[model samples]
Target: MSATALATWTVVALLGVMTPGIDTVLVLRHTIVGGGRSGLAAVGGIAAGCLVWAVASLAGLAALLAASTLAYDIVRIAGAVYLVWLGLSAIWKTLPRHRTEGGGVDALDAPGVSARVALRAGFFTNLLNPKVGVFYISLLPQFLPVGPAATAWGIVLVAIHLGVTFLWYPALIALAARARGVLLRGRVRAWMERVTAVVLIGVGVRLATTP
Candidate 1:
């Protein structure tokens, strides 16, 4: 790809990554609950998801999804369900007596979550997000050249997008982690958990109902 094309893609990817979405929420939740390491894993997963979408778009698999209502519905419902489950799980943890322990930097030092679960969550989150697939199918192609370099440039653009996303989430995670000390005490913790739970559920419901 030309230098200009690469630069343009970088700018576009940065802008896209800066826009808040499900992945952003996920990272923030992990950071607040589990600390920086968990947040990083969440970001890694999200990036992998985005990469999956990019690959599917480039391979025209996303087009097939767009064309088949059944396929689209299947993925959409599955994603929505997963999101709702995640949200509800967060909410469940907010129960008055329940205390979340481990599963953060400390957990990372130990056995921690399986790599498969992390990668799967990341991949599925992006893959099941039809909006992301549509975005890649539509927006990505506009900047892509129609030549032997097309696929190569497409991958470059995706990598840039993933990099920007990764960069953004870490900053958010760090900020949340820093603020955790103040937010983790007294009613603030409970309130924050509730708010996060509500936000996740709201987003899940919206995704489920949207056309």
Candidate 2:
């Protein structure tokens, strides 16, 4: 990629990374409950997702999905269901008696999610989101040059985007981790869990209802 093109892609990547979204919320929640390790796991998961989207874009897979209604619907529903499942799981964990067991564990004791699980969740979340496919099929290509180098350059651009996202999320996780003390207090922790549950559910609902 040319210097100007690389710079422009960097700026776009940074902007997209900084924007708060479901991934951001999920990472923050993990940070608050499980500290830096969990936060990193979440970031890794999200990066895995981005990589899948990047590859799909390069392979023209996203374009094929975009052109097929049945394919799009299947992926969209799957994404919606996954988000709802996550939200409900969060809510269930926040129930009065269940709250103390999971949320109050030390970061080390919990050790957060397994790397493989996180990566898989991250990959599928982004891969299954039709919106992401559309973005890759439409928006990303607009910035790519034509010819044999297009796919290669697109991969580089996506790497830059993922780098920004990975960098940004850790900062967010650190900030949330610092607040762990306050968040761990009985009522405060409970409230935070409740809030996170609601946010997850809202995102799920929105995804399900969106056209």
How well is each residue in 84-113 modelled by candidate 1, as lDDT tens digits? 876686666666545535433222121222
lDDT tens digits by residue: candidate 2, 1-211: 5789789878988877788888787787777766677678878878877778778888988888888988888888889888777767666666555533554532222322344445555666776688877877787887888899888888788888888987888888778888888887666765676687788778777877886
lDDT for model 1: 0.73
RMSD in angstroms between candidate 1 and the native structure over all alpha carbons: 4.1
Error of 2 at 126 (Å): 1.9
**Which residue segments of model 2 deviate by more than 4 Å?**
99-120
As for candidate 1, its clashing pairs are none
Candidate-wise lDDT, in order: 0.73, 0.74
Candidate 2: deviation at residue 185, Å?
1.3
